[model samples]
Target: MAFRLTPQDTSFFSLFATSAGLLVDATRELTRLLEVQPSERNAVAERLRTLEHECDEATHELINKVNSSFITPFDREDIHNLAANLDDCMDHIEETADLIVLYRIGEFPSGMAEQFEILSRMSEITAEAMPRLRGLKDLPAYWIEINRLENQADKLHRKMLAELFNNSTDDAVHVIKMKGIIDGFENAADSFEKVAHTIEGIAVKES
Candidate 1:
């Protein structure tokens, strides 16, 4: 590890962990979309929106801390980028949940559960990794797992798209709505990978 002239401010790690914890909460709420009746979807979306707002607040706090601090845990730009990327993950998830309610989507395809499971796993591991940012210790495993999950998500996304297009009974409007939701979830997964990538960059630079 590179020598530091000043003791790192520990509060940044806590803020990062708080942001990641909200991600886990948001993804958990996403699972409710699969369980609830169509009428109940708006409630779930509302809950996710609330979580997203909380994440935004956390990001803002982190940024303000970065701006005011004389020294940071890492590069100021890296701290800014990490917070922005974490916020992006929440934004994508919230928007995806909102899409389902907006389109009044019903009976999510079975594959959506798999997607949710992958995202939940991603969020859980991300939250686990946040505290470790204090030392930039044992981070490679986190990014490696995120990359693997992302590849799995990519394959599943393509498979779901193919299946959606191949179904003969669904109407054009139905297919379009499902496609939008499918793409939305994929975007959320991609955002999580972006967070992992940002952390990996930080780890390499600090090492």
Candidate 2:
């Protein structure tokens, strides 16, 4: 049987997906902003502020939805965890963007784009995982693939951090900047894993 979303759940999740989509767009925008000429640094900084506000508002609304609803499509704990995980993702992204703006980072690193690319893919995967909550029992197969993405994310995060520490100069600025970037990407991966964990929890209950 096809699982359906309640009107409330549908509204809540639509906002969730929308926020994730905005995060992807913001990531790309930040990438482009960093590539621009030094003279335009102020504009990129302003854009970061705007994106941060949007992310914060979206996250808070999602939390409110989780709190106010007496009934959820899944377990209350699962829903609460899901909301927190999603917020964590946005939090990391926004934090990193602010760091970039504060530093007025004029030059783009070569491999940073690749991490963002993987993160975007993972974001879409997480969104796909959300609607499946309503139909958890029907989709045992999904858990495997979702878990696969989580593994990929973990591997990529480790590799990226290793490269960051290995190849980058020993300057404190470089270390801090690279670590911030790596942490944001890694945390996004962790956020996706949290979603998987919620689904797994639901699966366990059903079984």
Candidate 3:
């Protein structure tokens, strides 16, 4: 039998997919922010801020639809959780970019490139998966890859922390700045994993 969604659910899926695309844009901006001049960082962050705002609006629309709809494509609770989780991912992505500008961090740690790389990959995986939620077909690969990336991110995060505290002779001030930036990156990675988990749960129940 084919899967079917009420028209409202289809609209929700479309909005969710749009938010996922925004996340991809945010991740790309983050990577670009890492490579650019310090003076240009603020401008890049501003663009991310705009994307984040759009994601926020999409999330609100999803929640409002859930509240108003008498029937949902999947479990209403799952729908709510998925929407919130996706927004959380976007929140962390925006926070990572905003903090970079606020802290005026000078050097990008070697480990940071790896973290953002994983984030970029996760965003692509997530953007792809959101639309697939409609049919719940062949989605195991999406969540599985996200889980693997989350594990990879954890290892890199630990390595970054070890380098941050162990090898640096910098003053307490520098440590504080770098720590904030690294924490943001770690949070973003963690949030992406949460998104994957929520999607997997929905897929499992539907299948």
Candidate 4:
């Protein structure tokens, strides 16, 4: 545990928690993309876009707070990295939803729901972990679970790609579009892991 001689700004934790909570909301909207009719997908994408923008605002606020504050809970660089990575997670989720709408994808692959489910779990755990940054307690488990989930995402991604490519009926264009969406989800999952890794690094440095 790290001891601070001066009082550190604890609001950073609140901001981080808010940012992570938005990620959960964004992932939920992403999952809704799977449920809504194609005609209604645009609305869902728009909602995701809104969530992404809110995330951006939260990140910007965190950075601004960092710049102005004399004392922070952790290193400024780590704070910036963590905020950027959280934003990246939301960005990827929004981009994936946009692609689904832009590509006019009528049906999803079999494992897509599973992919979204993983991301949802990642976001949920991430939100849960943010408040713990105050003490940096019990953080290893958070990052460890994120790593495990990311591995699951990678394997599922490979399986999705193989299945997509193996399908003879899907046109080349269709395969390409599907690949883009799958890759986007994988990227989002990777972004979550990046957040976890950043948190882990902070824990190490502060411990």
User: Best candidate, lDDT-wise?
Assistant: 4
Model 4: residue 126 alpha-carbon error in angstroms: 0.3
Q: Please give the lDDT score for candidate 4.
A: 0.94
What is the C-alpha lDDT profile of model 2 across 51-170, one tens digit per residue? 667767877786787789876665666666766676677667667756666775655555567666666666666666656555555555555765776687777777777876778776
TM-score, candidate 2, is 0.74
* Candidate 1 accuracy as TM-score: 0.97
> Which rank order by lDDT, best down to worst?
4, 1, 3, 2
Tell me the tens digit of each residue's lDDT in model 3 across 167-191.
9988998888888888888888888
* Cα RMSD for candidates in order: 1.0, 3.8, 1.7, 0.7
lDDT tens per residue, model 4, 5-110: 9888888999899999999999899889888899999999999989988999999999999999988888899999999999999999999889999999998998
Can you write out model 1's per-residue Cα lDDT over 1-207, one digit (the tens) per residue? 687889778999999999999999999999988888999989999999999999999999999999999989999999999999999989989998898989888788859999999999999999999989988899999999999999999999999999999873789998988888889889888989999999999999999
Better of 2 and 4 by TM-score: 4
Please report, as a residue range, the 10-residue window in candidate 4 with the lowest summed lDDT: 163-172
Cα RMSD (Å) between model 2 and the true structure? 3.8
Q: Compute each candidate's TM-score over C-alphas.
A: 0.97, 0.74, 0.95, 0.98
Q: lDDT score of model 1?
A: 0.92
Clashing pairs in 1: none
| lDDT of every predicted structure (CA atoms) | 0.92, 0.66, 0.87, 0.94
